[model samples]
Target: MGNRLDRDQVVGTALELLNDVGLEGLTLRRIGKELDVQAPALYWHFKNKQDLLDAMATEMLRRMNALQEREQEAEGGSGTGTWQETLAGSHRTLRRVLLAYRDGAKVYSGTRFTDTSYAIPMERFLAPLVRDGFTPGEAARAFYTVYCFTIGYVIEEQSAADDPGRGVKGIDVAERAERLAEFPLAAAAGAELFGDADAGFEAGVAAIVAGIAATRERGRKVN
Candidate 1:
């Protein structure tokens, strides 16, 4: 047990263990054991489990931002696209990052970022919206509207993928469909609602972007 263990090393190891133990079972003590350090040693870097989780979330964002940058570079450059494009792209990349790890949405939900690296992407995301006439507050609101949707969507998505009996699948689609056979739409909606995760997520994001765009036009009318 060296006295010089750094935060990144600890966080990195914790992430390594996450897919196996998940957030609930991912204790600081467990991480310490995995790192071959004492639990108290971890406190030098993080105050507690929540603090460590925040750090984990920050690391997740770093990875997500990296993926976004690489994708942007492959496409051309990092220039911000239309507000809708940027917003939609942000959700797509974010979902991929979260789904990459088990209980990732749990680790991400309600965790404050431990660093300022998020500012760069936030700046790039907000710039186009600002140029398109969403006041800073409105732009921020619009971003969160979509951002929250993505996080929540991934949460359910991961939950369902991990355990099919949970999430929307908890409902007995066949039984309900049989009971509601008299109603054509009710009988058929279950498969459509629960099927095609990719198409469903993209459709929801598209709807949110349309709403945000509508707000920009409404603000113009007000001004």
Candidate 2:
């Protein structure tokens, strides 16, 4: 496993450890063991476990940016789609990436990337919103709105998926049905209230994007 370990190598190994052991079990000592190096060797690359987690988060963003670029290229350089489409696509990609690893959303939620490289993707995403009439600050806020929503959604999704028992404790399908039976409207609503997660996510994304557009239009009328 020795090929002259570097920061990227350390971070890469740590990310693998993350997928295997999750955020709670991950530690520099564990990562070092996986890399066949001493715990102190990791400090040479990352200051501490938090720094390693930040690096992992940064790597996730980097992969997403590269994926976006590839998607745009596949579209024959015409760009990925309209601003709304692009934002939705990016959010979906973020969710997929986060869900790929154990506690991924939680790890990313704790990170504060010191890497300036993330600015590339940030600028690329915001440019369309700004061009579409949002001020730079407005564009940033809009992006943050969607980004935070996606992160929170993924966190809940992962938590439920990882521990189904914890999610619906005492609420089995039959119990859920019985509970709703007393409420006529809820009983009739049925699966619509708790099914089709993808549709639910898309509906939320559409609402946010439309809200941003509506705000932009209001600002236009005022000026």
Candidate 1 lDDT tens digits, 1-223: 3343588899899999998887778998999999888899889888889999999999999999898888889989756588889899888999889988987888998999977999988998899889887789988998999889988887777765456454443455677788888998978987666666678789999999998777667877998
Pairs with backbone N, CA or C atoms under 3 Å apart (clashes), candidate 2: none
Off by over 4 Å in 1: 1-5, 164-185
lDDT of each: 0.84, 0.76
- Residue-by-residue lDDT tens digits, candidate 2, 94-162: 888887777788988969885888898887887777777678998788888999988887776666655
Q: TM-score for all predictions? A: 0.88, 0.85
Best candidate (score: lDDT): 1
Q: Which pairs clash in the backbone of model 1? A: none
Each model's total of backbone clashes: 0, 0
Worst window of 10 by summed lDDT in candidate 1:
161-170
On the 0 to 100 scale, the lDDT of residue 27 in model 2 is 90
